[model samples]
Target: MLTINKDKSRREQIESVSIEQLVPHDHLVRKIESAINFDFIYDLVKDKYCLNNGRPSIDPVVLIKITIIQYMFGIKSMRQTIKEIQTNVAYRWFLGFGFSDTIPHFSTFSKNYERRFKGTDLFEQIFNKILQQAIEHGLVNMDAVFMDSTHIKASANKKKYEKVFVEEQTKTYKQALEEEINKDRQKHGLKPLDFTHEKVKLKEIKISTTDPDSGMINKNEKEHQFGYSAHIACDKNGIILSCITTPANVHDSMVFENLFNKTKKNAGKSKRAALDAGYKTPPICKLLMDEGIVPCMPYTRAQHKEGYFKKRQFVYDEYYDCYICPQGQILEYSTTNRKGYKEYKSDPKVCEKCEDLGRCTSSKNHTKIITRHVWEEYMEEVEYLRHTKECKELYKERSKTIERVFADLKEKHGMRVTMLRGIEKVHMQVLLTCTCFNMKKLANWIWKKGKGGPGKGKNLEVLLEFFSKVVLAIIKPHLSFIEKWGFVNNLKRAFARFSIFGVLLTFH
Candidate 1:
């Protein structure tokens, strides 16, 4: 009763008759193609290369597109990108590859990026283009844009980063000094605890390292890390508006307001700039309010420490230009400065009889002084934003809006660190990375906009139609002896490259 016969379930075959019909079709590659200024980029890079007598610039359009295609799929190395392009038929088609062609080598890409077109304003152009395009597409929501900062970890150059002290004038921990001495001795011939090359940049010698001025110590903080901090701005759709990098030692308060102002031109309709406490300062507050930006940042928690009178407790008399203490004590105005700031010192007589002296005054002479930055209007407004529940919700949105772009740039593009050194060199490198990033994003959008993704034979049929139109227009007489339709389709397999097949063979 057990059925063991595994017979072939064969179906009958029948002879078939062939049928053919002429169908009307036309190629409209123009409509599906993106409206990017590839020619402008090409012209710009070409001009730069001509100025530098650069190595063969492989049609800047093609080179940029290839680089972008690499980025879209997260390919890290240029060499691998070249190989992929040379092999994959869809990739080849996207890059306008003709049969029997070759991709540019890795070295060419490196040399092009490193030496030529280094400081060109290409990134700004690309960024501007994207912003403009997003504006056109109504994708950018500039209403009360969110603000945040993400630390991009730079590539480590062992020589550039070393033990550095806070407050460059020699007052450092014994362990720190010893570590510095050890570093100098192991690398340079300098002796221990000498302070020769510490703060004194001698003409006779400089810190001999692979990178000369990669971000150095803050000298005022416990953490002695030396690198750059990127202040990035983005719209609701997560496209970058602007970015500025400063020495890691640069106070976040100083750069915070400026970053907001720098991105104003790119803001489609934004009115508020929100950031963290790292950007809070008196001068910065004044600058932001003056520029009509409703700046929002949380007050520093240090003010609420166990043993300090928070600056918020000090009340100012704009009429008398002085500070009034809580104990009905009048602090005399010390000076009226050009910065519109006035400093007030607590009356010595009042402090002499104050009840909470220890909790309030730590001054050497029992004098408590407070300086009014004269920009309290902005501070008051910003402080209000911090207290409200709505602003709190807005602040939470900032991380997703802008930080995602940074993650893509760092984790995906392998640009977490600068490949170069020195402030100028690093700036250029950053601009270049941003430029490449935007181009890649634009190219990806363009590739996908053509009815389907270019990587999936989206344009192959249209390509045949294009060639057929061309043949009908000019080459029909020459090909009359051979009557054939869809000739490009017939030629596809014949001309297609098996380089990718070779790649498959290698794995096999």
Candidate 2:
């Protein structure tokens, strides 16, 4: 209140202090410095070269550490991420950087993340790293698990596809050939081949300039879009254990079998599996039972499409082995075990003139055909799952836990479309995005622990001491104005050094 004037002597001292030390003294990113485990991932790819000639685009250890950093902080691009470590006090400290050093270019990050490390198993390595950390931290409850799948867009774009007329298809193909021919001809003067050959046949071509391998499909009765589905298996605490990717057209119901098998391998035999209505089916229920897993999928909507008494209405006669329909009609064995279970059918002669014939059979002269699986007893067990309170609670948690995995990857990690154009590339993208999700969750948990959760004061002190030393120059910008992270000075510096393509090389 007493000082209103700016004097040369007073300003000089402040200027010297500012000029001498622009970096922050207390870095907030220290909370995440030692939180994640990168060694497990580093050990997996230590000998594998990201590039040919025994050269690595990125040291496997460095790549994983930086990628985990980018995910935890929600950094948008690789270039910006590096700049953050260079200038941001918190990031620098967390990344273990010292003063008088340059941050790696954004291109370095993109190159490794999008290109070299694009393999899904590599990402799975990262995910397992965090999962092991969570297990060590006692954050994952191995007793019960809930699984559900949702669509996580591949790195492809919607603009990659457009409807083409049949007549114009050949013309388009010819034009593309002409362009390629011209380029090859003008450069190397290569001759054109015959167009009348029998090998070419396609009515319409899928042309996505951004990502060609990714197909366009509709979901939730919505407009056409490009993407893949993310299938996740998470524990009861909503901690993800495994995730897989499939084409957009692949239904969630179909992927349940393999996903269940993978989850079983990952969790071992003790955990109970929870699923949703989308997973309810006779085939899947039987498989889970064989593996000694408790099935909790809700009844399929097919059970509610009312007509002539759904399968539930057919009462079985134990002593004589037949079905008793609601109309007091006894369906005695007509075909002997042709399609598993005791065979039963209505009398065709009696059905020809029956009053309920119109509603019961597609043909007036034919009786309805119903075949039960040999494992009908397990299906009965599935039906009983709906009657319990615990099952209902598990179903409610299904949406909350699994759906958010997709939303986070798509909305935050720029995983809406795949850049690589093939099933292999798309699958890897799904795996990586899932791994990214787990690392971020673990980072947040570490921060939460430091801020005071169930743990010893001594252990917290030890963690803080170790992190503080590694991240001495971390910058913690005022939290009130953190929304400007996208345009932070460090981010701009990072991007200027590397275009998106340059960044992609770091990953591949």
Clashing residue pairs for model 1: 154-417, 155-417, 166-219, 167-219
- Tens-digit lDDT track of model 1 for 283-313: 6666667667666676566455587677667
TM-score per candidate, chains pooled: 0.65, 0.68
TM-score of 2: 0.68
Residues 1-508, model 2: lDDT tens digits: 6977666686446332322255342223433444654566656766555445754354566666676566555565556677777766555555555565566676775566555555547766656666777778888776667777665455566765665433322331233434444453343343444445535454564545665545456756887776667678888666778777766656666777677667767655534667776766666677777777777777665443346657657787757757777677888754423223434688778777677766676754578555554456677797897678876776677667666665676678766644545667556555656666766666567767665323436675676566544432232333224335543454445544444323322321
Q: Given candidate 1, what's the lDDT at residue 389?
A: 82
Q: What Cα-based lDDT does every candidate model obtain?
A: 0.59, 0.61
Q: In angstroms, how far off is 183's CA in candidate 2?
A: 62
Q: How many steric clashes does model 2 contain?
A: 29
- What are the runs in model 2 whose C-alpha is more than 4 Å off? 1-28, 49-58, 79-87, 98-100, 109-120, 155-212, 303-307, 318-321, 332-344, 404-429, 443-508
